[model samples]
Target: MTAPAALAGFDEVEAYHDAWWDEIVAQAQAPAEVDIYDKDWRFLSTVDDAISGDFTDLYNDAGEGKLAQLAANPVAQWISENVTEAEDLHVRVTQSHTEWAGKAQTIEESMDSDGFESMNISFLHDLQHAKKIYCYPNPFFLLQVQWPKIYPYFGPSVTGVKTLLHLNLLRRYQPFWRLPADIFSKTAWAQDFEAANWPHIVNPRGTGLFNDTSMHCIIATRMGNFYDVVKAILEDAGLQLTATRWLPGDEQPFPEYATITMPTLIWDVVDKGGVRGKTGTLLDGFMPFVRSILGDNIQETKTPVPYEEPQEYSEDKWGTVKEVPAVVWYAAQRYTTATGTGQSGIVKWRKTQHKAIASAILTGGKSPGWVNTGVKLIANAILGYIGMIFLNPGLALGIFDEQIEDVILAFARADLTNLRDEMGRDAYGEYWESSGQNGFSPSTLAAFRTGQMAVQPYTSFQVEVVNGQPYWYGMHAVMGDRVSMELGMSGVLYTDQIRTARLTFGPNDPVGWTLAVGKDDDDTSPTARLARVLQAVSTIAQQIAVQS
Candidate 1:
């Protein structure tokens, strides 16, 4: 079915995306191996040959599927938007700063007093030193798409590099990968499934859960018209723009923001694992722990074919290949325990029904002593009995634009730069009454401007001032988007070293929130942090709404 006429461009964009995917795959070159260079962490570096030599392997290997799913993203579009935006922004800032500076001098000269000393200092500082920057939410998956639909790898990389983290996570946690596909895809594990009798086996499809980990930030934002841009962001959060009104006297819209609210959203889990109620006790914990160490393993009690049937050959980690019986298996029972003086072996399973991949380890001598039959059996039982309940974290349902009006009002209060200093502030000391862009090339330095839109504490540090006095002293540290400031009298440290806004999360900002979410991943921005905080605030409210 076609979307409504209102969504005209959306379909075309979707078609473009499909075609783009096909084209990129054809254009994609798979080398023997690609050495990944990570400046921050060497352990993150690896040689990805999964896409290196063979096309067939590329399709079969899991990593390529994940990368291919994410390739041809509109990163170029964002880069281009930012390039033009920087120039335009530089022009706007210089013009505003010049006009404000002129009016400031006249007001200050008329009233000079000691009490006004701090006010003068503050006023002068704002004009000559403090900066104003533009900010807006830039969440990944800005469209109404969910992560699982795009980032199928289940867990987004902490480093924001898909290929790097996917490979690293897989290599680092091979054991975790063995989890049932449904649980692994959700990046969750059932630590205690025995209580529920591992319900997933009876109904595998019911275990999947959704989590809304959407983080809105600047680095991840794409450039677009203001109206359409707001709508797109809202859609990503499953919201709608229900109102639009012009200013009292102006033709332009008043605030240019949308009011987003979820009147109702319900999720009732009546079966809240009253299943694990037995395991809740201190005594129960001991039994589970003992069972865990030795494994309350369940072994296959049935096989479709006899153990004597011709076997299949499988390779082991130690390079040896062995033949194991080929058969379909079903049904497992708890591990066999000692009947008398002692137990004969850890577990007793029908050889015909044993899984070949696992049997290979036992026969290939790769199984460690700790991995005795009983331990293996119990581990398998726990994994199969393990089941998890999930609640879709739903996309970024945060009212990110919630504080837009407040933020804008805060910026409006900032007076302009003064007349004399405005000239010095201008390039070549030529102050244009009607400001000129001149050499004000928009650069990354604007990222550090303190306040709401400020990126310093929210994302990274992008500015470098050399042998110059600090500006935050007289000015409020609030940069742009509502960022709380963390500058001391020492201000910014002047060093010759070129730094990206990679590591500077300002002073009192929620640095930990985005630490796992990296700047390159476009998930580490002030908007993302604020949105997360706001969304968390209403979890119970949302839950109640859901129940209603």
Candidate 2:
């Protein structure tokens, strides 16, 4: 459940003016061209001047001993010389998030509390490590917002400004698929994961930002066979394992459940799809990163226009846009039934404040905003409907986001049924055969994972006989949507990848100015803004998915 955002015609129109002015001045882009290609093979980002400043003042201001240790390490020095050579590229090598798992009590307690990792399940500890890593809200997952039906009415300036920001977001977003492997390729998390007994889906090249990396995992066990499998690998990767007798807070009898996480495989992405840090991807061959691939930094920022504080609706004066849940938005037509006095014109997305426009448009009314966004939204809705029709495939991913995602991992449903093999097929085959569906049927057990959603990948697998060759069909589920086990007769699967899925959700994904989107724990960095919009797109994807 999320607090709503409101957007009205006047405010939306005003912001349109600002974005238009900003674009005319070319103030909405990267600040400078970065020399990142030389280090593109690795999934690392060049530190910007801001991060460099933080690095320079780190020891005196932050007293992080890890930097002191790394500044002395030979490997760290080598990384500095070859990869992080830019003044802005200043960084320090630090240990992975294995340390938390080494100690067992936290796991025990976190299980007791209603908790799940907020970011990608597997990357939870890394993100929290706070030395080299930082956490951003799952930008795609905001629960309460949706795109409006009147979008076809917005003027060109409004659409143009939005398109500009949206395109920039997409460009910045597409290349980040390479970071996980760069962060973890040298560690045991990736190594042991590859050798594990469970069937897993991984990009053959490495971890993909857009690929599903979930695999079957036993989150915790008294049995060494299961425990050792994870423990040894994690320990080998220098991660510590935790054990417990009681749950985290209350003295509840806590047992273990299946836990899995996505892993890195960047080399596979390039070797296979050739998305080597390029804005656009070419599946047929490699597209190397060059200076041309990276855009110049945005040095100047447009000062945002502010809206007057929203007062209660008054007919004489226009009111703040009404906000409502996307699922129940149509019910809000009472707020602004189209009077037909004048044409339904472009609405204002409130400045800084998020509000819904009054429902003024009569049904079937025409507007450029609707014409523009309506077609796209309808197309997306149709696709979502088709997805639901194919398989009520009873599993999906969700996180209980307390402003940020690492708070909790939850399933939409969880009912366990041991497939009684009446017709005598393998477990999955028998189950699907009995159910008369190609995948798990809708049930309580639709989506369930033990720990945080971001760090703990759900434990499920798809066995596909592709051309008589048995393969593990990748399993990816996101919050609020039906389980899309779309083995699409090709390697292209569902959009559990937040970046891919949210954009696919059309209007449900909140698209507006960076600061106006759901607050990313108050972080306004370009990366954080990217996380908000990009993650919001995918986060809301489930909302669109379930509703459409």
Candidate 3:
């Protein structure tokens, strides 16, 4: 989480005053000629500025931008640009939880358990890489904070603001989707994983800011028999693969799962629908799916009220006319409650409470004074102490978040039966049926689970190879000593290309980069504020002791 910001009702009061004054002045003055196209013309000019500006400084100030630059390094760029052209491509699959497979009937059963890359079993298809690469907590949020200069041009309208967001999304988030192909080669594939793989979803994007909603992935439509090779290897180990689906006639798949169950594909969708970067509109074709899920839009209008007569219009020429009303037109300003789940307005009440609590953090719920800062410091310290100690639930040690996700999915009656099919879980599910899963002996999961095995891609093919033979091997980063594997495949896949490629160039690993941003490791982050509070408290205590 984030610290609550101080509330400055001064802004609200100033806004109301400004609106009232402007309306009164307009009522007094003669109407002037205005060009209807002026706003449109200005908007077009602003868009041009956005396209032409060198926002590197602006980007440097944003956390997301820093991560994007990391992913766009030369090695990652090479993998992203070249892998698409390769005929065969392989994506490493990762387990959702550390110990989810522990409950399985056998090692083979655990190998086929549901994981993050099990989209072929969960959603039936995977998102396309190039077409859908939008990440959120909106990178623009940070950029706008750092560079307010651009906001004056783009903040006037919803379209303008969203346009700015879309541009930032494309520039800062595209690289997230185009991450290095073999970065996770050491990891194992989930059951039902096919030609497409979305590794970004697993690591770098794991930060709370990105979450599962980040539409970043790799779809292997380019050429190559890597899928066939992996299929043979997996089947030899008595593991079945479900075919992942693709859209018909080259239509791109849905970018995120939230988009799948959305009712309408409309413009108001804040973040859902269609290929992310491919569409030119703001948020691409995505809409505010969150609002829709909550309920119908609740637009409430307040009745207009008149400004006080003596104080507001006493000195005006029309003051004597009782008929003259100095009404503040905005007294009727509308406020919408987008969430109307009909829980007796509890949602709105909670939002209000949250907003007030956030405001009180910075202001200490008091007027400005010399002691304001001290009060805020004390308030934060007290709250922080309470939260970190008494209020906090015990740390979730050794518990994988994926286990919770599995429970939720299970309660929702999610079916995992489709994951056990012999072929990839696509329309062509039977294409590889002839290749039986009886070639290799069962219980071979130990090879992948018990050793210091390093995954090495074939010199010429997408499959991993060792001593001129296709082999399966991987190491657990946390428990490298526990499991090892060296499985067999039919072909002699070479390994020269991946071995020679520069895969180690980077400022920081993407996953680590995500975890580092806004983390306590930084002196300027929220943790620093707490440190300052502690120092202040210590100083005050020392002064009191000296006085005594």
Per-model TM-score versus the true fold: 0.13, 0.16, 0.15
Residues 96-193, candidate 1: write the lDDT tens digits.
01111100111111223643211110011111110111111222222343332212121211112222222222322232233344432322334312
TM-score ranking of the models = 2, 3, 1
Residues 1-548, candidate 2, lDDT per residue (tens digit)? 53344546667789999988666334222132111112112324432221111010110011111111123334333444564323222122211110111000111101225443111011121111112111111212222332331111111111212222222222233322322333223343343233122212212222233332211122211111222113222211112222111112322221121222222111011111111232332221121111111232101112335433334322444333432111111111232445322211112111132221111111111123323344445555665677688865322222311222211121122112211122123322101111010111111111122101111112332211111011111111111111112222232222111111110011222211110111112233576468546644653343233323
Comparing 2 with 3 on lDDT, the higher-scoring candidate is: 2
After superposition, candidate 1 runs with Cα above 4 Å error: 1-167, 173-177, 182-463, 466-548
List ranges where model 2 is wrong by over 4 Å: 1-28, 32-416, 420-424, 428-548
lDDT of 3 by residue, 429-500 (tens): 111111111111111111121110111111111111121011111111111111111112211111111110
Q: RMSD, each candidate, Å?
A: 34.4, 30.6, 34.5
Note the clash tally of each candidate: 36, 86, 31
Local accuracy by lDDT, each model:
0.21, 0.22, 0.22
Q: Pick the candidate with the highest lDDT.
A: 2
Q: What is the lDDT of candidate 1?
A: 0.21
